[model samples]
Target: MTLTSTAPNVFEAGLPTFTYGLTATPHDILDDLRTAQSCAPIAIGPLGPEILSYSMARELLRDNRFRLPPGITLAAQGITSGPLFDKLTSSLLGLNGAPHIRLRKLVSKAFTPRATSRLQDTIREVMNGLIDHVVDAGRCDVVPDIARPYPTPIICALLGAPPEDWPLFVAWTEEIFKAFNFQPDVNFDESAIMRAWGELDDYVDGMVAERRHNLTDDLLSELIRAESDGDRLNLDELRMLAAGFLMAGTDTTRNQLAASVQVLCEHPDQWETLRDHPDLAMQAVEETMRHSPAASIVPRAATEDVEFGGYLFPEGTFILVNTFAANRDPAIYDDADRFDITREDAPAILTFGGGAHYCLGANLARRELAEALVVLTRRLSAPRLVGPAPWKSLLGMTGPTTLPIEFASERL
Candidate 1:
């Protein structure tokens, strides 16, 4: 596809800077992204040296030549690299085109609906178990106790992580994701990253060894048994996949849950509506996905000149698709700034993404959020915000650092 304009594209403009309001709430970001998309899929960046912002998510999703920029590495300050580096940036979700498709197909077998159905029981149990501890506390830090670790245990059970080491997995994932916000010039050191990466690789390597010895009814064991032409994931692939699952399930779901709660707090009327109907949980989730998306952007590298709307994106441009921005386009959703959960068109949110690279864990995440809200609404007599929810300064996933909710219930 060729761009329509004769004007030089944004990619040729220079590096991206913080001009587009990176700190803006999800709604504002979406508005800007929509404007950019209508004008051109590519534009000058808002946070770095002159870079291209690819805002047409649907179009980019359809094309396969647009690769993830090498500079757009998902590496954490202290937890990525070495034998397990491939998990975040080189796994099924990381690759582009055919190789990515093949790997995803192999992994998709384990994520089938039937397989996920079996985890609902565990999901309910995990939610209740966490609530059991903090239900009567009046208030607690929701991010760490409930939102962050909630997805870990469920995924561990699905992946067959040993009970004793589940806590360790949680710690490793926290270190990896928290690195997204690390400003090395001020807060981090090389030794800290080295230590974190070493521990992560060592733990995953041990798990790989165990899965090899005793294949169980979990994803890790199943992968060990999976083969093609007598070839399977070697040690490096094994470690990376394990790390990938941990990071994906942990950060994405935690932030989604946290952001959902924040949005509900901001719109008590909408919260009451959902509390009354309960079934609106699904719609509420979609609204949260759109209004306060967990992930802020998706990066891509153009392999050929592509045109969309009315502009050109030349080959070798570093592209950033502001998913958060696309969800809030005024033309697409009426009163896009408001947090109304009951809107008839609220279900069209782009939270789980679009196209082939859509999140594989979307079903699992919805299940967790739905179940959590069900139990939470019924048990808590009155829930109110204790303080303003503070968002983390992360480049990718946007979530809260602390969320304290006051409630009368002893346990949810």
Candidate 2:
């Protein structure tokens, strides 16, 4: 079942060209996944050539090794020379096994359910301010106004970033997603990224030094105090951990919020369902993750020869977990395409991923979304979309970039 060269004619005529074709694009991935899940759990790639899917992606993420393409990984190690688009394509998420697991675990403590729950009141207040800003503007771009600001404030605050520098943190974090090959013809945003990293690193370094000098209550302070078997984080590890958290929590949550709102806008009945029932917002967010996950394709490289779904994918093969497709698998979800908040049996969506790499930020993300939906529905008198919704071209994280909407005059 393995072929050396590219798979031919597997794509639909006139569809947009992408690594996963319709399966990867924001506009068409959901339907593509529903179709892919039924015909075969694994199929010849229309674009990725020899790539294969671990058909049971949702149930068995740990069954295979996930790594980035060697070429991409090597290229990523030298990110600064290039732009943002070029550097992030091969960033830390590309690592597999020990290194990936180690890095993820080093920072998991901050995103624990207990940790995020403590921030609920703060999250609500943050959402309140952002939504108020939107309402006051009368007509506003929800992406930058609400979606963009919400997550970074929480991340920056948790990381002990200064209030004035928080806006810069949000701007730089947002650019990382755009620097990869997903977009067309634009060079990477290297200067902004390097600048953001330097500012953040210096700030965090000072905070760490200060915390070391005199302990404090913040996460950065805690991380400095945390030790495993008398082993503390080295300076580089702390920087990586801080950088990773900012990257993981900020833009990712922003996209999820924007995508959730876009879905509600596209299906106003769903919006009404959420508005009427309010509780439906929880399930609605889950459905959006299933149907339009923030991360579309997860890249993995074979650590050794492996077999799955009757195909023997060779070692070193670049495999992609088409989570968007797996989430909509008919075998796993009934009527996967229909946005049913009350379906009651939605499978564990791949939005948080699974296995050792499962998102440590899961609870934090959910809590943020819960607060956001609650505040939006409760505060705005009648929140309505005001213009054509446009999506961001950032491949790794795609959502509405400009969602102009109007709320009642009194909502402000």
Candidate 3:
């Protein structure tokens, strides 16, 4: 893969400094880089070296010089020894080389798209039920009303856990992600992260033990089967993998769904197109992902000194591939700024990182988003933001934390 930069590498030439924190939304930070026009394909910042273009970001993700950012991330957070740090360093997102490949293969084998697809009936039911609550209200906050609660039931069912325990899983995963956030403030809660890890790990162990006696087609059972294949999958490995799935399978899809809804509501014409023709749900989902990805950045570190795109990345250099910027780069997409859902042959969505670390649940996430959109566009019309929809920090899985909208409920 060619690692050409759209501009001179920032590390050598006039280094454009990019800054990010709780003070600004991720989009605002990236927009500052765009507005200044001083930024290059790679911008150095507090978060990490920002990969601002498509080609460089994609290939570098697959390059051997780059690796998962657990070591660097742990150092940044001042968390060196604990269950939280260990989980950060040991999960699929943490490992590199042979172990990552082996574990990824086993997890991938169990976490199949077919398994998620089988739940189409359940997906529709969940989506419709969530919408049912707001159809009469004529206005609702999309995040808590839909996004936060939607994934829990689906993920719970997949794990063969009780659906009513969504709040517990949600709380645990929220703390779990704090360990990997690219930016954390002075108030970072180490205890919460450690506590969540411990509780979730123990709960997952119990669940796995209980499910082993009655193996079935659920994801937990499939993972158990993967372990039984004599790959020497141990208890911690199995438990952490399941916990990782709970985090990945929920938070990302939730944020993404909220982001997509926020984007659609903000763009009435696009929302109208989606509402008029529900068949465009998949296209709308793809466009939403590219335009306003839930995951603004994915982290990686330089495993060895490497010259990429005419820039030297010293070993242990932390980098954040800015999917938010790459998805909008003019060099890749025509009228890259436009929110048109009818885009013809727009590039493959880099919203999900490329290479091995590319999100395993991406396909399922897309389907879930599409199905939700179908239900939404069917039941609601002309969704417009009711008030200021506040967004979370861009340093991690970013999206509208609360998307209050007023839509004419056709079903109502």
Candidate 4:
């Protein structure tokens, strides 16, 4: 990639910015930008320059010169050395090259398709249990009634933690994830976030002690035993690794599940298709993600000076690959904006990031989505949005903040 255009550098240029806030705007500025792209391929986003086109975004994500952001990105936002910062340094999110490969390889053992398939039963059990509470309610907020409560319990079960202890994990993950929202100007609470990570670490330490004495066939036990030949996870690695997994596993799935249902409820005929053919749950999840991904942007920083998509991004330049826009690029799909689960052989989605740093919990997240939709579509009928399904900023961990829907419960 070379800079052929004589236009000013993107960082300094007056590039078009999109609507990226909590307030509900009637029209998505991304759609306008998506349609009005005769000039440039990039947009000056809230977090540096954003790659908006599908092809360009894919190229950037798979490129090697682009690496995970440095600590200064967080440090810029007042997160200068805390439990959260330390966790980022040690966890897969902050690591690059050899350390990343090592930890990802060891942690991936518990996330393989076979492992996810084996855990699918637990997913169903948890989904069904949550449904038991809301199924008879007729009208309820999906975020609280279903989505929020669903993923953490499954994560606790995966870790062999007591199901009743899910609330603690949920609280910790929520606080810790706030650190990633990238609101450098906002009054970000550093102490609360750091304290949450410390609490989670303390909990993981207790679990490590208990599980070491009596290991079981759960993810914790698997992490305890996981190793790459001579290399093994030390207590510190295990504690941070498990805590990171719990955080990743919970917030992401919760947001995506809520987003999936909101999309389906908006398209009743699609919901009918999913209900009639429950097997379409897998495809439905794919369509929902592609249409409205809960995990939208994959943040990266330039490791070295590189010209990509005909623009020069100097070393340490922050970039956000806008999957939310890329997923709907007219160049990619025939009917890119339409939410059709029946679409045949849809291309792979970018919701899970890409290449070496692709989400480790992707398989489990998909299983959670598939099982959750299957249970919901089968047990509930005539699902329709009863109130505004308000959404948060797409800048990070995107999803509806609250989704209220009305439905009739089935006798199951």
> Which scores better on lDDT, 1 or 2?
1
Local accuracy of candidate 1 as per-residue lDDT tens digits, 145-209: 78877888888887776678778767666666544442333544445544666687787788789
- Output the worst ten-in-a-row residue range by lDDT, candidate 4: 19-28
- Model 4 accuracy (lDDT, Cα): 0.78
Which parts of model 3 are misplaced by more than 4 Å? 1-10, 18-22, 35-39, 46-48, 71-74, 183-189, 227-232
Top candidate by lDDT:
3
lDDT string for model 4 (29-145, tens) is: 556667445456788865578877888877888887898775544775776686667667767687888888898898886555544566788888888888788777788899998
By lDDT, highest first, what's the ranking?
3, 4, 1, 2
RMSD of every candidate to native, in Å, equals 4.4, 5.0, 3.6, 3.1
Candidate 3 is scored at a TM of: 0.90
What is model 2's C-alpha RMSD?
Answer: 5.0
Residue pair clashes in candidate 2: 67-300, 67-301, 83-188, 84-179, 84-188, 84-189, 85-179, 85-180
Off by over 4 Å in 1: 1-8, 11-45, 48-55, 71-88, 178-214, 225-235, 345-347, 410-412
Tens-digit lDDT string for candidate 3 (253-320) = 98999999988887888887887888898999999999888887777878766678887676777788
Candidate 2, position 54, lDDT: 33
Candidate 1: how large is its RMSD?
4.4
